[model samples]
Target chain A: MANLKNNRYLKLFTSTFKLSACTFGGGFVIIPLMRKKFVQELEWIEEQEMLDLTAIAQSSPGAIAVNASILVGYHVAGVLGALVTVVGTVLPPLIIISIISLFYKAFRDNPIVSMAMAGMLCGVAAVIFDVVIDMAKVVFKKKRLLPLLVLIGAFIAVRFYAVNILIIILVCGVIGAIDTVVHEKKGAEVK
Target chain B: MIYLELFWSFFQIGLFSIGGGYAAMPLIQNQVVDVHPWLTMTQFADIMTIAEMTPGPIAINGATFVGIQVAGFPGAVIATLGCIFPSCVIVMTLAYIYYRYRGLNMVQGILAGLRPAVIAMIASAGISLLIMALYGQRSLPSDLKQFDAIALFISITAFIILRKFKPHPLWVMAGSGLAGIILYTLI
Candidate 1:
C-alpha cells in the first residue's frame, strides 16, 4: 500500500509537470490537456467530476491551472497530493522565466530587440483587447442589470478614478456574495 | 525586505486574481507599476509579451519574471511561491467544501457577478497597454507628435486578424516581431 501510494504521488507530480511545461497561451488551453491527462488517461477522476472541479477552479481566485491542479491532486491523494501537484505545476514556468530574466539586460539594450519587443507589445495589447471583448460579450449575453452595471462601473473606477484594484476586487466580491444570497432567498420564496 | 515585499505583493495578486490570468493584469499593474515602481510600463508590457509566449500560467510567469528582475534567483523562488500559495489553500478548502456540500449555487452566483468585473479589469489593463504601445508612454502623450502611427496600424491589423482568422498567438507574435524588424530596424 505504501509503495502504491508513493507511486501515485509521483505520477501526479510528473503529469502536472509535463502538462505545465508543454502548455502555452495559458488560461483555458490547459483545461483540455488536463482533462485528457487525468480523466481520459489516468482515469483518476470521472468525467462529470472533472467538469465540476473545472467550474470550481474557474470561479475561484488564482490561476486556473494551479487551482485545478490543487483540486485534482487533493481529490486523488489529499493534502500531500495537492502540495505535490502545485509544486509540479509551478516549477516549469519558474524555471523558464528565471532563464529569460537572465537575458534581461541584453534584451533591454539591443535596439533591434527593443523594436521587436515594441511590436510584440502591440500584439499583446491586441490580445488583451480581444479578451476584454470576448468576456464582455459573455457578460452581456446574460442581459442582467447588475452585471452590466458592474462591468461599466468597474471600468470607470479603474480607468478614470484610479481606484486601487485591490479595493475594487474586494467590493466586487462582496457585491457578488450579496447578490447570490438575495437571489437564493428569492428563489426559495418563489418555490 | 524586498523579498518580503515581493512575496506579499504577489500573494495579494494571487488572492484577488479571482477570474484568471488576464483579470489579474490590473491588480498586478497596480502593485508593481503604480504602487511600488518596481517595473515601468514598458517593461511591464515586455513581461506580458514574454509571459504570453511562455508555457504555464501568466500570473506565475509574470511573478517569476518580476521577482528575478527585482531581486534575483531567490526572489524568483519566493515570488513564485507567494503567487501560488493562495491557490493551494483556496483550492483545497473549496474542494473539501465542494465535496461535502455539492450544491455550489453561491459559487455560481459569485462567478456570474464577477464575470463583468473581471472583463472591466481586463479592459482597463488593455487601455494602459495600448497607450504604452502606441504612444510610447505610460499614459496619453501631451502632444499628438508622440504617437507612433506604425504601432497603431500594427495593433489594429493584429486585432482584426485575431478576430477573423484566429491564428495561434505564437504566429501573431512572430508576425508582429517581423513587422517591427522590417519597419523600425531594417528601414
Candidate 2:
C-alpha cells in the first residue's frame, strides 16, 4: 500500500513537471493537454472528473494550472501529493525566470532586444485578445442572461472604477447563489 | 526584507487573482508598476511577453520574473511559493469537499457566475495591454505622437496569424520579435 502511494506521488510530480515544462501560453492551453495526459494516457482520471475539476480550478482564487495540479495530486495521493505537484509545477518557471533575470541588464539595454520585446508585447496583446474571444464563446454558448450581465458589469467595474477583484468575485458569487436558489424553487413549484 | 515583500505581494496577488493567469496581469501591473515601482511599464510589458513565451502559467512566470529582477533565485522561489500557496491550500480543501458534494447547486451557481466575470477580467487585461502596446506611456493627445505604426501593424499581423493559422504561440512570439528587429532596428 505504501509503495503504491509512493508511486502515485512520484507520478503526479513528474507528470505535472513535464506538462509545465513543455506547455506554454497558460492554464487555458494546458487544460486540454492535461486532459490528454491524465485521462487518456494514464487513465488516472475520467474525462468527466477532469472537466469538473477544471471548472472548480477556474473558480478558485489562483492560477487554474496550480489549482488543477493540486486537485489532481490530492485526489491521487492526498496532502503530500498536492505539495509535490505544486513544487514540480512551479519549478520550471522559477528556473527559467531566474536565468532570464541573470541577463536583466543586457535585455533591458540592448536596442534590438528592446525592439523585440516591444513587438512581442503587441503579440501578447493579440494572444490575450484571442483568449478573451475563446472564453467568451464558451460563456455565451449557454445563452444564459445572468452570466452575460455579470461579464459586462465586471468589465465596467474593473476597467473604469478599478474595483477590488475580491469584492467583485464575492458579489457575483452571492448573486449567483441567489439566482440558483430562486430558479430551483420555481422548478420545484412547477413539479 | 525584499524577499518578504515579494512573498506578501504575490500572495495577495494569488489570493485576489481569481479566474486565471491572464486576469492576474492587471493585478501584477498594479503591484510591480504602480505600487512598488520595481518595474516600469515598459519593463512590465517585456515581462508579460516573457511570461507568455515561457512555460507554466502567466501568474507563476510574472512572480518569478519580478522576484528575480528584484532579488535573486531565492526571491524567485519565494515568489513562486507565495503565488501558489493559496492554490495549494484552497485546492486541497476543495478536492476533499468537492467529491462529496459534486452535485451541490450552490457550488455550480458560484462557478457559473465566476466564469463570466473572469472572462471580463481577462478582457480588461487585454485592453490594458493593448493600450500599453499602442500608446506606451503617452495617453494624452500631445504624447499620442509616440504611437508607433510599426507596433500596430505587428499586433494586427500577429492576431491574423493566430486566428487564421492557429500556430503555436511560440511561433507567434518568435515571428513578431523577428519582425520587430527587422523593421525597427535594421531599417
Candidate 3:
C-alpha cells in the first residue's frame, strides 16, 4: 500500500511535468492528452470528472494546462499533489524562456521558416474546431437552452461586430449570477 | 526594449483572456496584429501554426514567435514569459480561491456564464482561421481553385469519425495522414 501510494505521487509528478513541457498550442491542446492519461491510462479519475474538470478549469482564470494539472494533481494526492503537478508543468517554460532571454535577435522575419509555418496553421485551426465540436456535444446534451443561446450570442458578437470578448464575459457573468441568486431565493420560499 | 513590450503584451494575453487557446487567439490578434502592427496578417498566421504544433500554450508559442520577430531572442524570451505570467498569477490566485469556495454557487454561476462564452470563443477561432485562409487565397486568379479543400475535408471527416467512434485519436490521426498522402498523389 505504501509503495503504491508513493508510485502515484511519482506518476503524478512526472505526468504533470511532461504535460507542461509538451502542451504546445496553449492549454487547450492538453485536453485530449489529459483525457487519455487520466481517464484512459491511469484511470485515476472518471470520465465525468475529466468533463467537469474542464469546465472548472476554464471558468477560473490562468492557463488551462496549469489549472488542469492542479486539479488532477490535487485529485490524485491532495494539496502536495497539486503543488508537484504545478511545479512540473511550469518548469519547462521557465527554462526555455530563461535561455531565450539571451538570444532573441536572430529570429525575426525568417521568411522560409515562416512560410512553412503558414502551411501548418490550417491544421491547427482544424484541430481547434474538433475540440469545440466535442465540447458542444457535451453542453448540448444537457438540454441547457440558456447556455446554448448565450454561446450563439457570443458567436454573433465575434463574427458580426467583432466585439471585444472581455465585455461579453462580464455581461454573461453578471446575468448568470442574477439568475442563480433568484432561483435560490425562489427555492427557499417554496420549501 | 521592444522585447519588454512583447513580453508584457503576451503576459496579458496569458493572464486575462479566459476560456482557452481558441479564446486567446483574437486577443492576441488584437494586440500583435491589430493594435501594434508588429506583424503582417500572413506572418502572424504562420506563427500561429508553429505555436499550435509545438508543446506548451499556443499563445506562448505565438509570443515567442512574434517577440522574436520584433526583437529576436530577447524578444521571444520576454514574449513567452509575458504570455505565461498572467496565467501563472491568475491560476495561482484561482487555486487559492478554488479551495476557499470549492462549493460556492457564485463560483459555479460565473462558470456557467463562461461555459457558453468559451464555446463562442472556440467557434470564432475557427472562423477567424478560415477568413485568414480565404484572404490568403483571394489575391490569386479567380479560377485557380487555390484552397486546400481536400485537407480541410479530410481533417473534419476524421475528427467527426473519431468523435463518433470514441476510439483512440492517434489512429484517426494516422489514418488521416495516410489518406492525405494518397489523395495528394492521386490529384
lDDT of 3: 0.66
TM-score of every model versus the real structure: 0.62, 0.68, 0.65
Query: Every model's Cα RMSD, please?
Result: 7.1, 5.9, 6.2
Ranking by TM-score: 2, 3, 1
**Predicted candidate 1 versus true structure: per-residue lDDT over B2-53, tens digit per residue:** 9999999999999999766778988888989999989999989888877765
Error of 1 at A64 (Å): 9.0
lDDT per residue, candidate 2, A1-191, as tens digits?
98987888888888898877755545754565576578878898875576567657877899987898888888777788888988888888788777876776565567886777678767767777776776688777888888899999999997889887778878887888898999999999999
Fnat of each candidate: 0.75, 0.77, 0.40
Give the whole-model CA lDDT for all candidates, comma-separated.
0.79, 0.78, 0.66
For candidate 1, the docking band is: acceptable
- Choose the strongest candidate by DockQ: 2
Best by TM-score: 2
lDDT of 2 at A56: 70
- Please state how well chain A of candidate 2 matches the true chain A, as a TM-score: 0.64
Instruction: Enumerate the candidates' DockQ scores in order.
Output: 0.43, 0.47, 0.28
Model 1 chain B weakest 10-residue run by lDDT = B107-116
TM-score of chain B of 1: 0.56
